[model samples]
Target: MADITAAMVKDLREKSGAGMMDCKKALNETAGDMDAAMDWLRTKGLAAAAKKSSRTAAEGLVGVAVSGTKGAAVEVNSETDFVAKNDQFQQFVRDVTQVALDGAGDVDAIKAATLPNGKTAEDTLTTNVATIGENQSIRRVKRLEVSQGAVVAYVHNQQSAGLGKIGVLVALESAASNDALQALGKQLAMHIAAAFPMALNEEDLDADLIERERAIAAEKAGESGKPADIVAKMVDGAIAKYRKEHALVSQLFVMDGKTKISDVVAKAGKDAGAEIKLVDYVRFQLGEGIEKEASDFAAEVAAASGVPQQPAPVN
Candidate 1:
């Protein structure tokens, strides 16, 4: 049997908000598997099913640029947050996003596009790195536009024009008035920034994520000891709830918290005197899910100078 340590129990309890003894028992029952232990605790009604949402581990910057019918967003990643704050680097990202808007949303196209100083985007980035003295890369870019409707952009923390840490783009395809659609689009972009919906709809959600959610829901439903029909119904209800929570169009608007987003769009169409459809949205939160190695500059200098380092003190 695997050893169930006190630290493991404590971690589980912290994640689930379960009693320490209950967490320990769950860990023991699951043979020290953290995920299984979480499930065990949930089955025993000691932990909530939503506890797993905290495990996301990614990181990078998100930026958006909008021009008329076209808008583009890009995520540029550096090793540290200090690098993200460099004025030169921020300007670089802002410029690159404009390039992305012009380059058919293709990374390579943006890289090869010419900068104002007669150098390509890639060359400019290299030159900037030499001057700025930090490692940086363009991670990803996405573009959205509508032939008939307005594309609106929002920046969560505005550092300058067309630059911020978290950026969002909302595209509405409609025959609606430009003014009306622009207002609605901006509101929707703000909603996207605040809500962080996983996808445009349930269909666009990640397959692996859907499966993982289903597995967790199934495990939780199985403990009801209901008949097969009832258990299946419970699983379906759980999935529907998850979809409503994660999907953009189906989610309740965070603003009013009463109307669904789909209903909001429908009403906006009426207000605009034409049909308006939410085509797409992109939201980028800075430094999400990126594990960065901590740097110790003094230790690095000492190592270079041939000095020994002291070990960390034990707790």
Candidate 2:
């Protein structure tokens, strides 16, 4: 067998438009023969599939899967909402999310994992794109595992089991019964999904963001006609308030609208006969911060109906 080089992989990818893993596999199977590699990819329908890789896929589903004390979530995106309902795409998201469960929150590891059909994650994405007639992607994935506690998962806006528009995982570290811990974990995960808090505590919050807020607060304090001591106190107060509002455990639980999540966890811990800690969490909301062009429906309607009489005014 001929030794396949990196250049061969690159060339195969360029010609077939297939993913790196798929290209390499094809090249290796063809004994580093470029023409044979191209033919192999084409026969598998992977070449045409790769051509759709460049399309913007900002809409799709978030999927979650849990196994024992670990849980994982993944975001699989498509170019349009119509494809999100495709059974195959949904199944891919769900299966990939399960694969992510074994990855220990490593996105790269999850992407490199083999799919059930003996294809890499990237190859699955390419195949999905070709069959669905739209570009698709495994946008992100995260796994949460606990040594002595349970990792609970939640999927919001679910179209099917373990697949949805929002996915969340909450890790609760405790020596309590899994049943009790999981109940609390589910509620906490829901709280996190709804609130989108920055961190679990003030110390964990983004330092740069905190510093920026403090600067703004100090500037405001300087105009208050107070002494330096008073200004310092004012800045401290502002920062404390910011921390309470932004931190996960400090923030009020959205479901209840009054109690802090930390307080709830403390109470649950007592009932469970162990000290419970919110060690970590992961939340994946589909297309978060992905800007899509907004259209004015009324304007489009008028233009289509030939009723657009308004002319641009000279500035």
Candidate 3:
């Protein structure tokens, strides 16, 4: 069995929001497996379903750029947040995003593309890491384009012009006026930032994700002690609700909290004197889905002071 360290227990506590002793016990039961420990806590009703184990340890900027009907967004992750604030790091992100505009959102292509400084983007990133004293990478790039109409960009918690923690792009296909399209796009982009929709429509959602949610709902419904038919109905209802809540068009608009996003887009199009179709959208939240290494502060201090580290006391 894997030894359960105090840091592992602490990480489980943070992920499950359970007591320290409970977290330690759960980790032991799961053989020091973090994912299994979280599941054990949830099964025992000691943790909330919304609790997530993913850590946002990587820090950097999400840079966005819009030119005419095309827009691009790039995420550059650094080992530390302090580097995110560095002018050189920020400039690298900005330039990489601009490179992505022509790279068609391909990370490899963007890396090979030329920068204004006459060096390959990948070479510049390596140079930045050496000078900035931290590891960094161009994590992701996404571009949106429309044959007609405008692609609007928005940055939430803006760190600078076109750079922020959350970057969003909304693509509208329409013959509408640019000003009207941009206004509607900005509103939709802001909604995407807040709502965190999984997909543009129900059909667009991941099949695997939907199946997993269905399995969980079915298990929960089965525990209700209802008839098999009733349990089936309950599971279906839960899945339908999940789809409505997660799909962008079916989700309620954040602005009004009552109108569906599909209806909001229809009304905006009518007001703009043209028909607008929300063709696509992208929302990039930094460090999402990345599991960072848990920091061992006690060990760090012990090493710094040249003293042996002590194990945490178990209650």
TM-score of 3: 0.91
- Clashes found in each candidate (C-alpha, N, C closer than 3 A): 10, 1, 0
lDDT of 2 by residue, 199-281 (tens): 88879988987876676677667878799999999999988998998899899988879999999999999998998998999
Model 1: what TM-score? Answer: 0.82
Clashing pairs in 1: 57-289, 58-288, 58-289, 58-290, 59-287, 59-288, 59-289, 59-290, 60-287, 60-288
Q: Judging by TM-score against the true structure, name the best candidate.
A: 3
- Candidate 3 residue-pair clash tally: 0
| TM-score against native, each model | 0.82, 0.72, 0.91
lDDT of each: 0.80, 0.80, 0.88
- What's the C-alpha lDDT at position 304 in model 2? 92
Scored against the true structure, residue 77 in model 3 reaches a CA lDDT of: 95
Residue 217 Cα positional deviation in candidate 2, in Å, after optimal superposition: 2.7
Query: Per-residue lDDT tens digits of candidate 1, residues 36-116?
Result: 888777666788764244232333356688888889998887766677778778777878887888754777877888866
Q: Show model 3 residue runs off by greater than 4 Å.
A: 1-6, 18-33, 36-55, 310-315
Off by over 4 Å in 2: 1-57, 222-228, 295-315
Query: Which structure is stronger by TM-score: 1 or 3?
Result: 3
